[model samples]
Target: MNGTSFDGLTVVTVLYRSAGMLAETLPTWVRSAGDLPVRFVFADNWPADGCADVVAAHLPADRYAHLPDDGNPGFAAGCNRAVETVGTSHVLLLNPDVWLPDDALARICAAAAEDPDTPIAVGLAMHGGEYVGIDLNPVSLFIDRPAAVARAPLGPSGGAAVLPTALYRRFGGFCEHLFAWGEDADLAFRLYAAGLRTRGLDLVLPHAGGHSVDGDDRLQGFRAFLLARNRLLVAARTFTWPLLLVAVPVLALAHVALAARRVRQGLLRPFLRGVGRGLVEGPGARRQWTGRRFGFGSLLRYLTVRRA
Candidate 1:
């Protein structure tokens, strides 16, 4: 807990084709961000085998920087281009295979500066040592919790988290046509329909999960066609045409019974061409939906919330 306790935090990390896992987790994420005064931005999704000169040869030049290349149509548009070239007011969306520990960015910037409505803090997401199962079910867009479920009301886990930078550019920072998977549950369903409340933090980070296509089989079938067309463009932009016409035919028959159980695990033709390109681009990704009006008691409290 140093560097004036992450004054004006800005940890951001996007780097596609992560050069050998950012040369072994960016120096253990700059020694677990111990001396905090954070500012690490790295958004280099233009990876043609030169991940921004390997993060400017393993980070240094004044607490790391990197931007320029850009053009990588994924990871939420390279985290909205490293939060629009950083000038931090709290950002931390880390990933280069995750590592942080020293105090995990001064306990996630002291829980988003002791929360005065700057909520979104979730961390924990470990990997082989347990703690992963993220589950959110606004009528079942994502759900899989078995490891004796007990984390508490916290859902979306975009690698790691933390927010604010003007509420991530006023909630317009992650839907870049969801070039990657469900785009962090469509940015946590537009930050819970703008009332915003994501705070689950025991502050840990060990991820290493999917180290930039680890053992890639054609980017794992284009990451299952961008997670089956961004889960029907995040359920037609977070439901509500009468819950998206009763949850899009039961989510297209549960994605055709999970593409017939991924065709007996052989992952049937990239899961039926990612469910036929997510039903032909889930209606133009519903114009990148944010019609924010999640009622029905916030969909039964986002399907019985409980991620403490």
Candidate 2:
């Protein structure tokens, strides 16, 4: 993909009660977007705190548009809303807490342009200026199969990623039903399944770490619930039956042990309850993926993007 071929790219950010962070992030994005034929879209979720106005003050009228505030739509759903509103060939989904350097956008565009399949390029997210790896969780059965899980990375993630509009349409975008947690991992996995590859850049995307609750507090209970729930749901939809048969129970048992540890660490009730809830609700939340087919060949290509 070349600069001219991929010139028309639109950037979208899903802001949810993040007024202060957007105040700083939007300006950086504006500075980076200079002469790049980029348009910025902000879909502010409920309790918006007037972030749309804060963004408006920073970017030029022609380059920016603040969509009507929508209620608490999940991360993927909010991004889909912005993507639907824009007319660009590619869409960049940025989290409000992330701040990209002035040249990051241009560089990502350059990197993606090298591949003609409208490849999706993900930035290496950093917290306080350290390189962060984009984690890809493997199907549960792969847990004991260390060789398989070793092939992919698990993430404590969500920073910035650029996706082609056609790919989003072809892949049906994100699963809107996944309220918030695990949405990125779910999307990244689906992107891989749809013949679209994902990679973490060597360059870092500066961001203010976790958004769940506290910096160190891992939302241990709630996150355990979401991960247990969503990972199972994702595996069923995307994995082969053989892989599913192995991964599912092994992962559940691991969850049981991890929950026990959390209990010893003083969260027994919530941890145990989360496990139960995940077990009951997870399988029921089956997301049928009827999107495109991305076989092993595309996965090989995506792996090479890391070299690029």
Candidate 3:
């Protein structure tokens, strides 16, 4: 692992107003990356905030590709743009707020090197000052009230997800139209629909959550809309007919509870609008991604048993 023999793993991260956190996490990431000759691609969505300065301060300008786009494209788009330039066999969708342990990248790269076909591998995150499993859910909602009904198949941590470049290309990457929220879940479900499994690892990716948006309250309502909308968008596109029948009503139930919660914040309109949009767009999404056919048994196998 210490040798620079490891190759073909590109680390991709989208930076939006993350100069300060980059200053803290960049050193560790740079060290771990170098320990394994890993490539790093950074998408700077907001350049005026000193993100470039931070990169220049720590990493050699030529050591990594610091692609700066001032358009402030949404997170998913920024990541999608960065990924287009990657030539590696696998790409790690890493968040700027996450700082990897010294050997984390080496070990992660080792896993990928051992099995180049590893579909999706996600690490744990630090939330509320403690390590927590990634909120791995394929749109599960119950009277436990708006929570994932089953946490069996754990993974795709908000902090990071490692996926093969081939499968990513075949699946069309994250849906850029999603803009920001639910890209992870959408991709995760699509992977599941294709009979791919998301492997949850014990490695800890220490992430001070919310650094990108700083837990903004104004976004609370917008997030509510996204949470409601993406569930349907995800369900519609990924679930087969029988699974769709089972999922739609539960998705509706979750949206009901979500609308009630958003009413207090005066975000009911956006939430309702999101529902309308999802309904209108779901059919097209389903029709568009129909190139691949998957069986209903895949979903049950993926969501029923935990894979660690």
Candidate 4:
């Protein structure tokens, strides 16, 4: 809405019991934003110990707002709620565990300014001192391996991306039905079908991945269930029935084998439960097909090529 400038940008981040990470990352995030006219909206996903105090301590009262406690509704819902609560020209959906470099936001804004029509500008995610791949491969339903490329020809990494507020609202934001997991891919497919491009910026954001639910078994199982369920739901929502006829079976078989391997590692129950839930709930999940479909050429390229 503001022609790709960072004049009115709201950085939306969902906090899922990430108080410690917030304390570490927020300062860097604020510093990286530089002098851009920016505000922050944080959605707390019903943390056992509330994060309000932590948020307030880190961000000035006028610079940030925290959403009402709404019982762990998941990342997609939290992000959607944050987007609705803020009135800004652009929105940066960020993970709480990510620390931005000083020049990251400037780079993103510059990239957005270069192509105002592009709906999304993505930054590379770095973990353990290496760039992590975020591009989606629809055929395989996997993150594409890194390749030597200038921009993402596929999709943006949901963890650190800047999107125009207008386009985000127009596209209805992320799919809340997903609850968590695969919603990024669903949004990416929708953007791709609409002929909207997601450009990748050279900026890299350091992410300490999976710190929120790192050691909790129950949380891990629940996350696994959502991941499996949402993976199928995304496939169902994005692919044509004919393509699904082939792709679904392959996906199922692959998941089953993986689950079996997990079973051997004493992780059977949760893995099987996830597979079962995915099979049952996937069909009932929301369908986002809007007449536009991924072209065959893109499909072929996706199968044959790896993106960096």
Best candidate according to lDDT: 4
Report the lDDT of model 4 for residue 120: 56
lDDT of candidate 4 over 111-193, digit per residue (tens): 66666656554545454343433455433375532534544546565677678887788878888878876787777766766
lDDT of 1 by residue, 164-204 (tens): 67767767778877777677777676667656666566655
**Which of candidates 2 and 3 reaches a greater TM-score?**
3
Candidate 1 CA-lDDT value:
0.68
Q: Model 4: how far is 268 from its true place, Å?
A: 2.7
Against the hidden true structure, what lDDT does model 4 obtain?
Answer: 0.71
TM-score winner among the candidates? 4
lDDT of 2 by residue, 229-294 (tens): 666666555554565576677677777676667667666666566556656755555446655333
lDDT tens digits by residue: candidate 3, 1-308: 11222257888999988999999999999888774657888999988898888888887765678889898877888878888888887888888988888888888887777666655445444543433223433334311101122443333543477777766777788887777777766676666665566655557667776676556766666666776677677667766788778777877787777777778878898789889989988988787667443346765564466433
| lDDT measured at residue 159 in model 3 versus the true structure, 0 to 100 | 48
What lDDT, from 0 to 1, does candidate 3 have? 0.69
TM-score of each: 0.34, 0.78, 0.85, 0.87
Q: Give the TM-score of candidate 1.
A: 0.34
- Ranked by TM-score, the better of candidates 1 and 3 is 3
lDDT against the true structure, per candidate, is 0.68, 0.61, 0.69, 0.71
Which is the winner by lDDT between candidate 2 and candidate 4?
Answer: 4
Candidates ranked by TM-score: 4, 3, 2, 1
